[model samples]
Target: MKACNERRVCVTGATGYIGSWLVRSLLQQGYHVHATARDPGKAQRMLSTIEGIDRLQIFRADLNEDRSFDEALKGCVGLFHVAALMEFGTSVQENDHVRRNILEPAVWGTRNLLQSCMRSGTVKRVVFTSSISTITAKDEKGDWKPVVDESSVTPASLVWKTKNPGWVYVLSKLVTEEEAFKFAKENGIDLVSIIPPTVAGSFLTPTVPSSLQVLLSPVTGDPKLYPVLVSVHSRLGSIALVHIEDICRAHIFLFETSRAAGRYLCSAGSCTLPQIMDIVSLELPNWISKSSKVEFNRSAPSIISSKRLLDLGYRFKYDAKDVIKESIQSSIGNGFLNSQVEFKV
Candidate 1:
């Protein structure tokens, strides 16, 4: 609500892939940052290399804990809520586990954080990181819509019928985002949600991100992730994607842009499995052997759009090829994949 030149902001889930990068980006932009993480030690380890590390403060906070974020939110003019339970390909088969472990933490955690924000009195805008699962792009008859954008939302009833851990995770995001917007509006808080498809590119976290795990399944040839990929395609008609850097940049842009309201779809584009492999092959010629084969149709329809964010003058820094290439390079750098070995799906 008020403008300040101090540029003080707080980022939750600071130890995560996006959160760490955002912290670094903010620090590079000369902001005084308060970063919250479940384990401050891990947060320190991940963020120690940041350029303006001295301007950053790490705080231990949990979404499930009421008032935990109050201390962190104090004096901050903005908040980036990036923490959420993500179970992309899980076999946790229990309704209670789904509700308790995933759903409640996401929805109620948002409430807890927002309550802290309102109490802070200084936080003017809140930027929320949302998933593409919130956009189903389906009609009443369960058919694919011609084009999907900010208005498209996946129904809770549809998620409930699937009985899938992945869909349950989607439900968490869908419900949490709705709850966030509702609370923000009722209390007169400026809130913006950035919905990203399968996020790829390098990460700052110690482990590979769950989204990257699913995105890189083709190269890893991990059989367990096949179902997850199938489910994503079944839900959104194709593997919709966004670069990690672009998504993080979008988060900051939405927070800074005064007119950015409601939800913004932040996808670079969508592509089929064959198209993904072809991009990989072209980017890293030696990574995919001639024997590697994928039979899926190459053409993938673009079902989602980012026209709102584009109209706001935000541009994506990476495209499909750049995203996949950087992801592969990061995978190799992290020792998750062997550069010398040829990969096949």
Candidate 2:
């Protein structure tokens, strides 16, 4: 439980949605930050989101390139490994392409980064941003376990056999986290992995993240896209939701707290997709018309517990309703969504 403000820290994917916010938080806490971006020119645009630019150093590092992060890791006491390959439109037919693009980069990029950290000999702790997909592949029906925690994990063999794009992405995360833990253990690095559910909040970057894009699909009146949204809702059942800011705080908490170990599940609560649609409709009723068919599965929803984080005395600042409202407001402010109707929660 020592103050990390005296040490220098590095954040990979520093311009990304969650990563950008994390950089802002760390700078505000008076930490000297070494941030990495694949393209320094493009990353400059997002630099305005974080203050104290004088204390921030930017490095050019690509996750796919081995040893690209060596300079960034130099003299850093902590590392936040948040970069991952996430292609939104991967087809089942492109199995090999998916493996090469998404799976390999996620696993190998983590290995390369950890190797650099170990070589530098300055890194004492690593906070990895992992997904809840590693815990559960997909929602199941008919008398199954209704809760998922840190102990829950999807088997790699089972995920590989399905050959589904979504499952493949899950497998990539599973491998990355598992490999990261193994490397950290052997190298004596203090590693804390954060498993977060569907993250929804304001975007710090110019482009909308794939997760937010899916959440905003119903608002875009595309007939072809509506059923896909409905299908996702039916298949996923109840989703564990968390705000981006909360997840960033959880990462910082784990880094600063001495007792924090192993994995922590970060989520505010669970809510059905139809319930989310209802909230959205209240704000933008014109976005979702009465003619749109909303479907819900008649099965019990699964719950994801954040008791470990709670037990560690970390309080969530936003609930499911708050997440939706803030996201809509942010979208409007960012000009991602055009609506004349004012929305107040």
TM-score of each: 0.92, 0.88
Minimum summed lDDT over a 10-residue window in model 1 is located at 288-297
- Model 2, which residues run further than 4 Å from truth? 1-5, 92-97, 137-142, 221-236, 289-294, 297-300, 339-345
lDDT of 2: 0.76
Q: Model 2, poorest ten-residue lDDT window? A: 136-145
Q: Local error of candidate 1 at 35, Å?
A: 0.5
Clashing pairs in 1: none
- On lDDT, the candidate that comes out on top is 1
Superposed Cα RMSD, model 2: 3.9
lDDT tens digits, residues 237-308, model 1?
778888888888888888889998888999888888777778877766666543234455566554678888
lDDT of 2 by residue, 84-169 (tens): 75553455556677678677777788889999988777788899989877766243432335676888776677667764445666
